[model samples]
Target: MSTRGKNHSEWDSISTLYHTVVGQLTIPIAAGLVDWVHETVPLNGPGANAMDNGCGTGIVCSLLKSNYPTLPVLATDFSSAMIDEVLRNAEESGWKHFQARVLDSRNLDSVETESVTHLFTTFMICLAPDPDQIVSEMHRVLQQNGILGLAVWARPNFGFFEAAWIEACHELDPTYEAPTLMDPEWIEPENVRRGLAKAGFKSVEIKAEQQSWDWENVNAVSTYFFDGHNPGNTKWHDSWTERGQSIDKVRPLFERKLEEAYGQSDGSLKGPVPFCLAIARK
Candidate 1:
């Protein structure tokens, strides 16, 4: 088990703040992955359906609805709060023939074998405690020749922000130690390919590249991260608070560190975060 404890549980508390955290980066890529699925997979037809196994707040479902209004979409996430968000979206969007489930991607016991025509999981499998099992479950659920579109970070894309935050934490309390956001080997394309092959994916294609993102200014970027209740952000807050330090006191220092490294001419933050999208077939 990860020493960070159950990250999934942390995700539950930040369901509302999730969109503000990584939605800007993941949603566009999700759109692209959905479009990519459309090239081969039928969105709507008899026995034709799609599932977003690790759907966070149903970004993929919302996009799928826009593309195929009548498509049978199943949005599943480990967090009930996230499933609730999907349900809320369905209610507001008037989605038809859609379903949402609070299910872990690792063990999709509720999903049946050869059930979905396409499985799309953006920025999900990488964080899985057992990606091989997650991929195995995905393979089991997908119909013959079904495609898996998996998006993950090429590596943690925190830029200079993490180091600066750690610096501030150390200054506040010398006992501070930064956490590892991800495993190094898991991000390797070769390892991903090997894992997929083990999961019975015969044809696997992996692409690693930088995806550009924008911000009005660096403060906008900082505000989204610092001025939020995301688990990732909350940990820092908890650390700062437990150390008997006002969180506000460290903001200026962190801001200066960010501005020095990432600030643009117009005071905007940097862009073009790295990510990998693996398209595999069973």
Candidate 2:
């Protein structure tokens, strides 16, 4: 079971913004992981079928189709908006072998048991209402000796941004409280190993690495957190609206904290992020 709350509607609301902003921002990471999957798995053989669970913007699916044109790819997401984007992109790219579907990760009833040869999910399991059930579903869908690839945020820390935002929010409204973004247990490598093992995966290997990106200035960081189409920002704005508080009241304070913690001498922000990559065999 997941410790974090599940909100399926949130993805639908931010689908467009996520594709245009957040999904684009994570392209490098997604591409690198795809490259790793290509090298780690035998995806070039005849009749190779791959599924991208929670395939946001169809980035990974696109990469797979480009690299192995003959491979059949199934890209699924919970958001209908996201599925539309994926299908549109696939059509525009002339990817005839790719398919997109609106799917819930925890219960992939549409997929058949032992039907998939390769399964890949990037930054998705952590958001599931039941990560364990999702893993079990993954195992159920994979054929014998099939490979599973997963990438999730690991040891996620906002550095100084979180404290700054919380403080600023409190200054604006005394009763302001931060919304929980993820289940902490999901980020731990051991927990991920246990979940996969419980789901009948074998030879699981989990690796953690630090990944970072730079923001041109505090404004960019602020835009990403407050204006970006992601769960955190959406929840933050919702909380403020529920409290009858204006985000503008704390914008300055948040910017000030950004400057204090991540601002470069030239007024830019350097953020170091962490992620965990895992692979297992069914």
Winning model by lDDT: 2
lDDT of 2 by residue, 230-272 (tens): 7756766787778877778788888887788777898888766
lDDT of 1 by residue, 86-145 (tens): 788788889998888777788888889998888888877766577778888999999888
**Candidate 2 wrongly placed segments (more than 4 Å):** 1-8, 156-161, 170-177, 240-245
Against the true structure, what is every candidate's RMSD?
4.9, 4.7
lDDT of 2 at 16: 71
List lDDT for all candidates, in order: 0.75, 0.77
How far does residue 179 in candidate 2 sit from its true spot (Å)? 2.9
Error of 1 at 176 (Å): 5.8
Clashing pairs in 1: 218-268
